[model samples]
Target: MSGHGFHVHGPHDHELEHAQAGEHGGEHGEHSGMINQIALFTAIIATIGAIFGYMGGATQANAGLYKNNAAIRKTEASNQWNFFQAKSTKQSLAELARDLAPEDKKSGYQAKIDRYEKEKNDIKVVADKMELDAMHWEKQSDEQMHQHHRWAQSTTVLQICIALAAISLLTKKKWLEYAMFAAGGVGIIVGVLAALHI
Candidate 1:
């Protein structure tokens, strides 16, 4: 009869070693899971933030452009009204000068003519200034709209990159990481180029 269950002397401590290795592997798996969770959470937050940022900037730019357009219209209307008033005043002065007797009209007629001319000149200066100001504001509004559009496009690309990076962490996909990095880098470059007028 075999004293040790019909087996020759086996390698000692083999089962114990296997148990230790299994424990270590479990710990490693748990740590990896934790890391993946953190990565995913961060990416989600970044995506949400990018969306809100893009929305806010776009809204503000559009509102400002609308307000500027309204102001430009108001300035144009005011200038036209000023010109009309000056013309009407000059026509009235001419009629009054014609009604006066010839002997008495000479001095009064000269005074009235000078007054109407000065008033017309003043109104013309105001109209010119208003027109210049309106043009400047319109240019500024256009620039702001362009800037907002660029930012929105860049943000959308960044959001996509963040999502890809999160997936890479979960799956341990090296190619996905590379793709995310490339996309993010391209977006940043394009945004900078647009900003610098390139």
Candidate 2:
């Protein structure tokens, strides 16, 4: 029999079947119970691991999106700064013209210089605000990347737990079962930390 793409009869399947059919009724019942428990535990852990893996991927995507936003903001700020520089250059030229021009033209050049100054101030404000926005986006990207790592760590731990569960089933080792549960617990704790953005 097969379910969810996995064959029901694994390497130890025959051994378990023999144990279940043996004359030792009490031992057979206990073995069946252990199998059931392990099967249930594996199912639960696999589901949780899948969720953690999805979360990791989502956080990674968010980090990339946020980083892209930061870059765009930085580029916008740079453009603004370049515009401000152009205004400054124009202002300087106007100042030079004001110094050399006739008395009537001097007032016109001075007005141009004043207008450039005001435009530069406005551009500076916008550029500064864009820079701050870029910084904020960068910070958000860093935070999302950190959370992604936590989710990845949690998923890895849960995968290990699943491996331990398989080994315990194959070897009938109680210690391995306990270790599996411990790993599962640690994986869950890490998932919680990721959720909390810790």
Every model's TM-score: 0.61, 0.87
Q: By summed lDDT, which 10 consecutive residues of candidate 2 come out lowest?
A: 20-29
- What's the TM for model 2? 0.87
Residue 161 C-alpha lDDT in model 2: 98
What is the C-alpha lDDT profile of model 1 across 1-198, one tens digit per residue? 257678444456665665566568765555466556647655654764465456549645775975577597667858666775877677576757756649666677667776776777777777767776777776666666666666666666777777777787778776887777777776666566446534
Model 2, span 99-192: residue lDDT tens: 9999989999999999999999999999999999999999999999999999999999999999999999999999999999999999999999
- Residue 192 in candidate 1, Cα distance off native in Å: 2.5
CA lDDT, candidate 1, residue 142: 68
Give the C-alpha lDDT of model 1.
Answer: 0.66
- Against the reference, the lDDT scores of all candidates come to 0.66, 0.96
